[model samples]
Target: MLGIKVELIDKIGMHSSDTAMIFLEDVKVPASHIIGEEGMGFTYQMLQFQEERLWAGAAAVVPFYKIIRDTAEYCGQRKAFGQPVLSNQSVYFRLAELATEVELLRSLLHKATAQYCMGHNVTKMASMVKLKAGRLAREIPDACLQYWGGMGFTSDVLVSRFYRDFRILSIGGGADEVMLSIIAKEMNILPSKKK
Candidate 1:
C-alpha cells in the first residue's frame, strides 16, 4: 500500500454504512497519479461536483417516492376510528402534495441531466435540484412517518431509518444554504464584491 490510513467515523444515521476519515500524513503521491493539469485540481473538482450533486439529487427521488407509496398503502390498510386512515382528506391530500413535489423534482433532474449531456452548464439547475431534493427528502419522510404513528418512531421501521438518514441530504453535498447562494450568484442577485 502507498501508506494510506483510513479510520471510520461513527455516524448517527448512516450506521449501516461506513464514513471514513482518511489520513495521508507525509504520503507522497507520484506525478503519474495526478489528474488533469497540476494547478487545475480545484477546477476539476468543481466540474466533477456538478455531476456528483446531480447524482445525489437523482438518487434521492426513488426512495422518497417509495416511502410515500408505502405509507399510502399502510394508511389504506390501517384502520383509524373505524375507517381506513387513507380515507381522511388530510391524509390523502398531503400524500398527493408530496407526490407532486417528487414529480417536480424528478422532472427538474431529468432536464438538468439532458442539458448536462448536451454539453451545457447545469450548475444552477443542478443546485436547484439538489436543494429541492434535500428539502423533500426531509419533508416527505417526516410527513409519511406521522401516518405510521408510534411505529414510525421505532428503529425497526424503514421509514424511521429513512427519517434519520434523509437528514444528511441537506447537510451533505453543498448544503441547502450553499445551493441557494450558488443559485443567487447565477441569477445575478448576489451583491457585487466590494473592492
Candidate 2:
C-alpha cells in the first residue's frame, strides 16, 4: 500500500466525477483483509457484480422517467413555429414510445427484485434488466435531448448533464456486451468451446 500510486484520467464526459487508474507496486494484503474464502475471491466478486448490476438497473429507471417527464414539460412550454413543440404529433408520439420503454424496463427490474427477495437466483433477469437499462439510458436521453434543441447541446442544462452522465450506464456495471454474453449463457444459446 505504501508504494501504490493513483493517477486521474481526464474523460470526455462525467467531468464532475472522478476516474483514476491505480498502480500497485509491492502491495501486500493481509489474509484478514481478503473477502470471503482465500481462493474464492473471483466467485465473491461475481456475486457482488450481480447485486451491482441489479442496483444499477433499478436506479436508472427513475432518472429516465424524470428526463422524459421534464423534457415533455419543456416541450409543452417551448414553442416552435406557431405552436408548442409537444403539440407536434411526432414529438408527443416519440415521448409516448420512450415512456412505454421506460415502463417496461421498470417492470423487469421489479420482477428481478422480487425473485431476489424470494431467495431465487436472478442472474438471467438481472442481466436482462442491466442490458435494458443501459440501452434505455442511452436512448431516452438522446431522444429527449432532441426536443431541447440547442439548449440540450449546451453544458448549462440538466438534459445536457444527463446526456453526459447516462452514457456510462452502458459501460459500467458490466458493459452491454458483457450482459448480453451472460444472458446468452443463461439461455444456453452460446456455442460450446472446442477442446
Candidate 3:
C-alpha cells in the first residue's frame, strides 16, 4: 500500500459506487505477490472480465424486477383523467413488454451461470447477457420514468435514481458496443487479422 494514493472521481450517476483514481508513486511489489506469470497480467485481467460481465448482468436482475414491480404499483395508484394510469392500454402493454424482457434476460443470465459453473466456456452467452442487460437496464427505467412524469424527473424518486445509476450498465464493464464486438468475435464472424 506504500505510495499509492486513491481519490474519488466525482461524476454524474452511480455516485455511491465511487469510481476511484489511483496514483502509484514509486510503488514496488515483492516477487512473492506476483499473480501467475510475470508477463501475464493482461491475460489474467482479460480472463477476469468474463466474471465481471456476468456479475454486471446478474446484478441488474433483481433490481430490474423491483423497479418493474414498483413502477407497476405506482402506475396503479397514480391516476390520469379519473382512472389509474396503468389502466391505459399503452401503459399496461409497455409494462408487460418490459417485464417480459426482464424475464428473458434472467433466463439468459441463468443459462450462462449454469454453463460457467459447469466449467464450460460461456463467453458468447455471457456477452449476450451483458449486452441485453445493459440495453434493458436503460430502456426499462426510462419507460417507467415516463409513467411517473414530473415526479420521475426529481432526484428523490427511485425511478430517477435508477435512470442515473443504470446508465453505467451500458457504459461500464466493457460497454454495449464492446460486448457486441466480443460476441461477434466469439461467433467466428470477425475478419482475420493480417500479420
Off by over 4 Å in 3: 193-195
Each prediction's Cα lDDT score?
0.91, 0.89, 0.90
lDDT of 2 by residue, 1-195 (tens): 487999999887888889999999888889888867778877888888878888988888889889999999999999989899999999999999999998999898889999998999999999998899989888988999999999899987787888888888899878999999999999999889999
Give the RMSD in angstroms, all C-alphas superposed, for model 2.
1.6
Tell me how candidate 2 scores on lDDT: 0.89
Model 1 over residues 1-195: C-alpha lDDT tens digits?
466888899887988789998988788879999877889988888888789889988889999889999999999999989999999999999999999999999999999999999999999999999899889988988999999998899998789998999889888879999999999999999888899
Steric clash pairs (candidate 2): none
Q: Pick out the ten consecutive residues of candidate 2 with the lowest summed lDDT.
A: 34-43
True-structure RMSD, every candidate: 1.7, 1.6, 1.7
Model 1 scores a C-alpha lDDT of 0.91
Error at 118, model 1, angstroms? 0.5
TM-score of each predicted structure versus truth: 0.92, 0.93, 0.92
On residues 65-174, what C-alpha lDDT tens digit does candidate 3 reach at each position? 88888989999999999999999999989989998999999999999999999999999998998899899989989999999989999988888888888998887878
